[model samples]
Target: MAVQSLQAAPVPVTAAGRRRDREAMIAFWLFMSPMLLGLIVFTFVPIVWGFLLSFSRAQNTVSVGDFIGFQNYVDVLRDREFRRSLITILVFTAFIVPLTYAASLGLAMLVNGVNWGRGIFRTAFFIPTAISYVVASLIWRMSLFNGIPSGVANIAIYEWFGIENPINWIAGTDPPWYWLVLVTVRLWLQVGFYMIIFIAGLQEIPRSLYEAAWVDGARSGWTTFRDITLPMLRNTTIAVMLLLFINAFQAFDEFFNVLGGTAATQGNRGLARPPLVYLYQVAFQDADYGRGSAGAFILTAIIITVTVVQGRLFGFGRSA
Candidate 1:
């Protein structure tokens, strides 16, 4: 009998290999440099500068004078408009997040179940996401939700249903009718994107689990989905919710385009103006850079805090 001894051979690195590796690293970095540079220049620098401006007294946003040290923040926090705008955003987020989430999840489920033309349906739904917010808002305002009886919404309510008057969907704040417009536009523009995310998450779930459930007489689709699909999609759901919350908070273009008009009077501005709209008026209209910057930071903090709380509650990235 013979015993064999095994020796591990080391991987050989030639001089040419080392040179190629170095060159590859250099080339990779070269490819990345433009994007890295753009991020630093456009995103990072603006964020840092905005933070600094928040603490300073800048009238025109250009000449930063005297570090007033939180005066701007205090002023912004105490401002009625700022407080009101933030509150409005909170209310909007409360509604839009849930509605969008449910709608997207339902749409994803429907799209996932389709045996044919899945891509066509997904692309059809996702087409709205590509539409510019301004254009969508304009279409919603001018064509769909227009105050006149000729508008689609008014026609449905007033003509088809035989209501006496055409309700002003955006302008009427008596029952907060404007919320209907806001919520609908947001759902139309965003649900498709989130639906795609949900679809991706749904696809990752194994078919074997569903089959096993079916074998166990969990043949009811709703039962299987509730017991299996939702639980499996927990992290994905959390991510979608977080993103929805952020998007809701950052709502500006639609609100601005719909509500903000040529007349910049306080009377013209309605109740649904979000924080960004308020900040926009402050910075651009009133030329209050310091306050605007403070408002920006305050909104950012609110977004981060909400996200962290949600992540904690949902046990995101945590094992079962």
Candidate 2:
């Protein structure tokens, strides 16, 4: 009886089960078809085409047969405007990334500490992130800092502070108040998003750890935060910093709109322009697809390098 039980027969495949499995696979493929099709057409095709086009001298059109080895790359690198744009982005990223990280972490801690209305606070802060950059830029430029005495910012400055002259926030280069506008708008849009991320990270921390720390004579505020909270949040901090750096590098819409769109190209073209805007002028406006494509790859290489270096610095993929 023991031997017979040990050699029990295997269950047979049921016809209904087989049919259901096949139907499920078919449904999955059917559901995924649109996304797969779109990815291939929009993303994969462009990436491959742009790569090939970058190696060619395909000016005025992307029909790619001219085949210039590395001249396009050399030209892009040598162009002074392109170099200036790189510096502009570097500065912008330097300023925004740290500010965003600090603000996000601070807001996250504040929201996490609250005993009530947490959802409302989270929603209020995060709603700005959903707003279009162009729309926000318009609001900042037209309504808030319109360079007129009647503008909200100008009114505050003139009425409250007793300043005789209204500051031309965007157009003026003397003080470069434009950076203030750029940084503030970007900060307002992004801080909430990162705050939510930090909040999630904060929640993941075990309450037992904090209780233990408290019993061990760790103070409730800065001492506990510095020793326990920050160390516990290392992974989340690394992720947030990585994302912040990427977003800062991709800054374009705000700079373009707030700086005056095509009018930006008219005077002081070198001021406040980032790589994307410069690449746009090259590829779309100037019809130099080859150089534009090369410039894009160059920027991609820079971003990849920075991300890798950052990951290494933070021990991102390392085991604890």
Candidate 3:
């Protein structure tokens, strides 16, 4: 038989089809317009304006005063307090990242293994993520660790551990007991969110892999988890670590609420102050918009650099 020529016919676009296409496009843009408008007005414009302000002498006012040419950056970098704040954030990140990572992962494992009431356990663990950092900070400050004899922690310590002294948890910078308050509140607020992410990752891991490991005599719990669970969750782990690092670096709210003092009292007291808090004091309190903007950019640069380095180390984009 002769091979038939298989010429494909082009479908004609009718006026109705074209009209529908055009209407769909219009509707799509209409739905997207609000978000686009907000992004341009709130995010893009501020970033551009802040960048320009960083290079200017815009003290006490956002109006671009003069083209200072890195004067603001130089001043911000040379500020001793600012350097100390950077160190403080670095320490905080170091402690919080690993602690949060481990806690989240462990909680995820425990929740994943639950044979009953999984939703209840998951919800119970995750509810803390909904609590506001400011509110949690207040709870931690006023009720949990208020340092008063009647406070929860103080009472518990006194009753159980027989510690007579009511430890001034937040104010005692000499021993830096304040870190406990900061770390615990942040940990409580953050772990649940990351734990949920970890649980999702764990669920995605195939049961067949675990079964196969058991067959191979990797029956030991730690061995199976080490060889199977961890490797399977590499990408998820990296993502969680990156988020934890960035969040730790950007910590401000709890620090501010717990430690911030009135202008009359000046209660920052040179302890546990993160870079954001320092920038807030510089920009808002001291009215040094130029330097504040500069410091903000500097912190942004540092974050980007660290993220890049971490992604590289973790092989983030590679298949796990």
Candidate 4:
């Protein structure tokens, strides 16, 4: 009887221990309830719904509709306009990412070199980042590249270079050149944001490394940059590249505002039309919800794939 009692005593204790752990877990879950609820409502719910919607024919007004299997995706694949838009988006990303990185790195270097008013310089560079995409697009359209003699670019061209006529930088369909204008405006708008990122990355880098490089007699700019700055900035560089690529691919506002939605300008000739814009046209303008949803999903897939590829190629988050 004594042995039986002792053996039975541990069972109750173990049961009590398990109950205590269960209660603690319940409390922890309660603590996290609000955040979990918010994530479900805002993020997870939307993502799941969007994915489901991609397979259906639901419009913005209608919540649910007939399931169309792979018809939506098939239509998108066969769509020439959608294909063109995808290519345009890719081209835009290709141009903007490298340009943004180079410009941001240069701006960061410039700010870092300054002995006084570094804050002011940093703020000035970041001011554009504070502006919304719509506001910035409007500003660029009206004030900077307005395409008239009174416009900034035109005025500068006429006064400084003595060119008679102001060129319509955004209106022309000339292959590479119109693309250049779009890319330049995008670069001007985006460089500041990336500059801030680069500045932060640069600041985090230890001064000891540079001191060591100096001690090693690495006085040349190329050698020091290649050996010290580039290696140290690898993670930051990957982040900047990813951000620039995503922003470039998802670009819509500037293109939409600058290149208004006339059918003539909808094709490859127009600078403003990216995949998102085309998707917007199909979903909103034409009311082809199924096709639009498919395009959106395809675009999302492309972004995910490209980001993964970039991560693999650049080894992001793998090292310090």
Alpha-carbon shift of residue 313 in model 4 (angstroms) = 0.6
The ten-residue window of minimal lDDT in model 2 covers: 262-271
How should the candidates be ordered by lDDT, best one leading? 2, 3, 1, 4
Q: How well is each residue in 39-84 modelled by candidate 1, as lDDT tens digits? A: 9999999898888888888887645666899999999989888889
lDDT of 3: 0.91
Best candidate (score: lDDT): 2
Residue-level error in angstroms, candidate 1, position 221? 2.6
- Model 1 alpha-carbon miss at residue 112, Å: 1.7
Could you tell me which 10 consecutive residues in candidate 3 have the lowest summed lDDT? 1-10
Please, what is the TM-score per model? 0.92, 0.92, 0.94, 0.84
Q: In candidate 3, which residue pairs get closer than 3 Å at backbone N, Cα or C atoms, i.e. clash?
A: none
Model 4's TM-score against the true structure: 0.84
lDDT of 2 at 291: 91
The per-prediction tally of clashing pairs is: 0, 0, 0, 0
Per-residue lDDT of model 2, residues 1-320, tens digit only? 99999994764679987897799999999999999999999999998899889999988899878998999999999999999999999999989999999999999999999999999999999999999999999999899988888999999998888996899998889999999999999999999999999999999999999999889988699998998899999999999999999989988999988887774454644569899999998999899999999999999999999999999999998865
lDDT of each: 0.87, 0.92, 0.91, 0.80
Q: Which is the winner by lDDT between candidate 1 and candidate 3?
A: 3
lDDT of 3 by residue, 103-220 (tens): 9999999999989999999999999999999899999989998988999999999999999989899888778889999999999998999999999999999999988877887885
Q: What TM-score does candidate 3 get on C-alpha atoms?
A: 0.94
Candidate 2 residue runs with Cα over 4 Å from true position: 1-21, 263-265
* Backbone clashes in model 2, listed as residue pairs: none
**Which model is ahead, 2 or 4, in terms of TM-score?**
2
